[model samples]
Target: MNTAAFSSLPLNPALLENIASLGYTHLTPIQAETLPPILEGKDVIAQAKTGSGKTAAFGIGVLSRLEFNRFNVQALVICPTRELADQVCKEIRRLARFTQNVKVLSLCGGVPFGPQLGSLEHGVHIVVGTPGRLQEHLRKRSLRLNHLKVLVLDEADRMLDMGFEEAISDVISYAPTHRQTLLFSATYADPIREISKKFQFKPITVSIDSSHHDSVIGQHFYQVDKARRMSALGYLLAYHRPESTVVFCNTKRECQDIASTLDNCGFSVQALHGDLEQKHRDQVLVRFANKSCSVLVATDVAARGLDIKELQAVINYELPWDPEIYVHRIGRTGRAGKLGLALSLCTEAELPRVKAIEDYQGVAAKWDEVAPFPMAYAERFQPPMVTLWIDGGRKNKLRPGDILGALTGDAGLAGSAIGKIDIFDDHAYVAVSQDSVDEALAWLKRGKIKGRSFMVRKSQWG
Candidate 1:
């Protein structure tokens, strides 16, 4: 019952103003309970799911204590994937906006090291990165953490699941022992506790569940023969027609097969797995997040740290052996007060596993029959947006505003026609309404951005 307002806390005036401007009046449970300890520079282990305002809890703490004048690394936030790292970096930057000369950099894999090295050479205040890339930089002596005052491990459980224990250990070894450490994860498993014991010093624990799972997300299980599992999945998709869906497969091969089948069947689909090159992986994630792809087929490992906002549904093609993962899978949807749907296809052999899930959740599973397969001539499912790849990006000083101006100003397209715009080191991806993709592409190819012409092409997604 600690219903306290954020103004009650001793936060910087500018930060308080920023929070208010962002429409946050009161403190979330996680922010109320954890921000105090975090701001006090005490070690903490917080158990909060995605979209629980955990980022701001930690972001506010780090930004408040930042030494902008020093210009050295003051905070280090390690994430499980490049996507999550980018997201954390963005949130932290947003929180630090009112604070002048505060620089936040994200260092992750999938991009070249030369640029990262270059940025490190220039110096930054906070560093958000993945274990692998950070470890590489540590080994090369390109990144130094001696001045590090705060160390936050966001999504600690997902990092462990991705097999980054050794990398995390090595990276932590480089950080000074006197720094404040914050470990935040959705689950408090034994391994997480072990890590907290080893690295944290008498840390306080906080767990909050803002999402009432069963109430917000409708869950259903359908039993089908192993041979008809794909058919059942397609039938479920056709029936639900979720604008954006994530289908989880147990194996990489299955992930690819299902994506291929769906693509062939005229569903806009993309497959994500460890086998994909970094370039392809980035494209897949961008397309899905921007609504250019209706379905994303992914393995557990590849889908780790995926935080897709407004995700309509989650389809569990195969359940994981651990019930905890099952919780995490369905948790992707039903976020941000949105109603979600979770459909699972199980065969006879997997019935026992289904029971385990039911027992874990402490609720009897609801059984449902899949809708009959759609007719051959049925309207095909297509995503509302289409992605266009532009060759220029951060290196060329490209900004979302620049692209937006070109599209809406010269192309004469409405501002609403533009979707998510992501700028990388050397390339940028912009999502436009499918109705305006051709015009946007043509305009970009013909128009100059920032007084320079860069190649523009449509991204081909299966």
Candidate 2:
């Protein structure tokens, strides 16, 4: 038997079958190295990047030790952002599909508290959530982890960067010290070490090389004048014309300014930063992920927990002070054995940062000159999809299938015309091909979804 195969692990037969059903024949490097210790019910600290199958590794461990009969929360996975928390919950649910009556809930802020409270009342075996909301529930006595068997701090470095150390410590204080603890982070910085020393008991450290290989991600740096930064960015976008790209900025203001400039220049763009309202943030993220938006301008802090698949390129409008952050930013792209592009613009003042990155990666910086491009080239770039927002969502018992059926069956549109359909609590968003937007919107307005009329309109970004 191949040691890299999932069957090599001591997993339940049903779980093995389910893993196979999910098309996971072999364990990812992170999973293969950490699953043994995780299954053995031991404390493990694994340093792995996003999209490394870490979620499945921890999700499997949580489910393997879950007590289905018991209503108490047996496993708690703390994440840095609500987006990440929701993603973790979804992955865990998929992993637990083999087992019946295994409850999993996501308790994140930016949504109604009453619903979370109600879910807690009904009982859940696994809870994946952020720090603030979890702290609120713990304070209200609506959530209790006295029976927690396994505790996981997913993206521990991001959590610490978001200043959730106190809340994480507080949440851990509620859990039993005798239980197993697992910490996963992309970078094992000093703070990460401190977190492990403070919480984990003699944790088995597992570090996977988080660095990107030169063969995988093509790194290019262009020297630009500070005043011509916006022009440089536009030239890059016009040059590459990536269908999906993320432009990483170093500040919230810069993030917004770059997004606005690109939007004015006729590119489908949105900004993600700490200052945006939660609803706006959701819209920005949904539009970007669904391909309705082409380029996403975001600060590192705001880009935490972003897991976009098949991202073509990553642009650093301004280099981060830390090389690890550069690695984390570029790591978002070139995932799953796909080619990735990392482009950077550095001014004379920032050349030192370039040297730092080169020294850290142990590779020379590849320099490229940005040739002038016609301004009209920017106008030619547009997203292939347009998103429509429906007034009703999960709260009104709406689902993706209902939206799809309405478009295909009643709207007389082919299924291929529709892209990704995302259903939220009070609203839903569906991506329609650019050619089908008008028809889809017109039909959605006159027609009914699930036999109920809904206000529908094309979503727009500022």
Q: Report lDDT (CA) for all predictions.
A: 0.89, 0.92
Clashing pairs in 2: none
lDDT of 2 by residue, 186-223 (tens): 99999999999999998999999888887779999999
Question: Residue by residue across 1-462, what tens digits does model 1's lDDT show?
Answer: 467988999998999998888888888889999999988889999998887889999999998898788889999999999888988988888888787788898898877899889889998999999999999999999999999999999999999987899999999999999989999998898999999998999899998853346768999999998888888998998888998999999898989888888877888899999899888888999999999998999998898878899999999998888887888888889887789999999999999999998888888889999755743433468889999999999989999999999889888999999999999879999999989999888888888888899998989854
| TM-score for candidate 1, residues paired by index | 0.96
Clashing pairs in 1: none
Q: Supply candidate 2's per-residue lDDT for 447.
A: 90
Model 1 has an lDDT value of 0.89
Flag regions of model 1 displaced more than 4 Å.
Answer: 1-3, 210-212, 374-379
Best by lDDT: 2
Task: Output the lDDT of residue 176, model 1.
Answer: 94
Q: In model 1, where is the ten-residue run with the lowest total lDDT?
A: 371-380
